[model samples]
Target: MSQLVVEWDRLNHEIEEMTALVGKKDAEMALLKAQLAKAQTEGPGTEEVKELRVKNAALLS
Candidate 1:
């Protein structure tokens, strides 16, 4: 029926939007992981440590 077709189209559109959002989140997580790794390797200074703490808190929320 036409109503079913409309519902199917809406669900598909929602799924596509969610998929794109997930991709963006994946990229952000990768970048955050890379930054954490780099900071660990370089040995964080006081300011860097503070910054990292702020970032950690933000992530926890």
Candidate 2:
């Protein structure tokens, strides 16, 4: 039916949008995780990981 077709089209559009958003979030999460790992390995005061060190020092202190 026409109504069914319309509903299917809407759902497909929504799925496409959701997929794009999920991909973006996944990329962001991957970048954050890499940064966190780098920070952990590089020591606390280096420019790339200064924030991580500060938080860890504060927690320990």
Tens-digit per-residue lDDT, 1-61, candidate 2: 9999999999999999999999999999999999999978776556747777778999999
CA deviation > 4 Å runs, candidate 2: 45-61
lDDT of each: 0.96, 0.91
Locate the minimum summed-lDDT window of 10 residues in model 2.
Answer: 42-51
Give per-residue lDDT, candidate 2, residue 20: 100
Per-prediction TM-score, please? 0.70, 0.69
RMSD of each: 11.7, 8.0
Q: Which lDDT value does model 1 have at 42? A: 92
lDDT of 2 at 30: 100
The sequence of per-residue lDDT tens digits that candidate 1 reaches over residues 1-61 is 9999999999999999999999999999999999999978898688988999999999999
Candidate 1: stretches off by over 4 Å = 44-61
